[model samples]
Target: MDAAARQAVNLNVLRRHDPAISAIVDTSSHVVVYNFDSATETWKKVGIEGTMFLFRKESLNRYGIFVMNRLSTDNHNEELNSEMEIQVMGDYVIYRTLDDKVVGLWIYEASDRARIAKELEKWVVAARQMGAQCLQQSWIQFDVFSRHLAVFIICALAEDLLQSVDTDRVPSSVSATCMLARFRPDPPVSAHWFLKV
Candidate 1:
């Protein structure tokens, strides 16, 4: 089968699984309608308001990281509200208003886990210095995928830091206990984990 044939078959399968996928794939246009509720006759436009990036994990692993912004509404119509249209883009993601005004620009990429963690640390310190906690909070509200990625990076960085610590340099009494506590990974890392340090 040719490339086009394979894509068609894939699209068919996607549409069969969830017809909403068709709306995203069929359009070359940037505008997307989401959180549609036929019963309430309400819908939201992607990148208009209440938009956030949901990382496609499979796509992130396969093709350098990718994310799509999902628009949400408060409509209580549950049955038809399951479908949401998001425009998945690579690298840079741009947000614009209906009047063609630039609202936001997001630069996302996958990098060495430890390096990213270090960068996040710097950001936290800088935020603290600049009294930008509110700014960070706003960021937290919108970027769900990046928050998950930050958790992973933090955990990796913690593991690396713990491994590099020389037990011989520390007092013998608490060394074993410290090592044991650092290695256990259950709750993963939290957004405020850097704040504790």
Candidate 2:
């Protein structure tokens, strides 16, 4: 398939599965994932050492499930453990354990949190519109991935825009501090939430 067609298919696959994945793509271009061992549940030396179809397709939509699956008992062997790492230069996130069962997750930045909000709203609205109370109820318990609440401020902005903005009006200084506080290891996934797709 042509690049565009492949991209479209990749997006559709991810979107149908989950929207959170797309959010990761908005902020950065690449991420890194780390995997763990199954038997001892410690850091394993084996890793996937390859790219995932989702990353190759270049869709942001599947990031959430991609992450969830890598961290959970989904699509991967139960013994597998995963984490995400971002490679700003490489434009992809590699998910793997020390063992090197690397599964590459394409990275995106900007929309991480917003995507979560949009998907949450979309699901809520769809449920209400369709009169699916059961589904709606189920969704209520789901927690948003905590990674997205952060704001990334350019270093130049820290020196320029933040200094000029009034503390009361927006508190640019405070905002910048908050952003830095939320910053995780650029890729955002640790052994805790990182997973393979």
Candidate 3:
């Protein structure tokens, strides 16, 4: 099969069976985080190590909002320190201090489960030896495997809708709304609603 055909098949498989395998298979082009220096107002490239997720930019922003909310709610009274360790569960990442205090927690869907698990294990070992705190504490750089995943899914759905239409005219908003509903479903109003909202 041609490359496009193969990609279509792969995307179908991912959408149907494993939505978590969004990370780029090749590691060389993974996303890298850069640290912003408040003093100089400059962004410096931070070394990239461990597993990174390939999240749609919008999804990444949404995830950041969730993380910020968790940080505020969970660690409001706790002191921020440099001796924290990070652990990755199925879809959640947890942070704890050396004294075994939970400091932060965030939910992230992995691009590739097996690769992420392996990388998380390696990072745990490294964090144990070198500590988890960095120069800039608040910034996180996620490796985006492909920014096109969301767009591709939407476009594919749009094409299908167009093909099924009896006339040439179709409302763009209708397709957009359908796409949003398909990808992001509504959730109950609660503390964890940030993940879905």
Give the per-residue lDDT of model 1 (tens digit) for 96-140.
Answer: 323333322233332322332343334334434444555575565
The TM-scores of all predictions, comma-separated, are 0.19, 0.23, 0.21
- The residue pairs in collision within model 3 are 21-111, 22-111, 23-111, 31-143
TM-score rank order? 2, 3, 1
lDDT of 2 by residue, 1-197 (tens): 89677667656655565443342222222223444445666543232322233221223122232332343334322111123222222433333434455444333443543343344334334434444544454444222333332222344445466568675887545675575445523534443342221
Clashing pairs in 1: none
Supply the global lDDT for candidate 2: 0.38
Give the TM-score comparing model 3 with the true structure, all chains together. 0.21
Q: Give the TM-score of candidate 2.
A: 0.23
lDDT tens digits, residue span 1-197, model 3: 99667656644543343353342232212332333455786545434323232222123221111111111222111222235444555544445645664422222336543454454445446444433333222122111212334555666777676667764364655664465556542332443322221
Task: Give the residue spans of candidate 2 off by over 4 A.
Answer: 19-34, 37-42, 45-50, 53-73, 76-197
List the global CA lDDT of all models.
0.37, 0.38, 0.38
TM value for model 1: 0.19
Higher-ranked by TM-score: 1 or 2: 2
Worst 10 residues of 1 by lDDT: 75-84
Candidate 1 steric clashes: 0
Off by over 4 Å in 3: 1-86, 112-121, 127-197
Regions of model 1 farther than 4 Å from truth:
1-145, 173-197
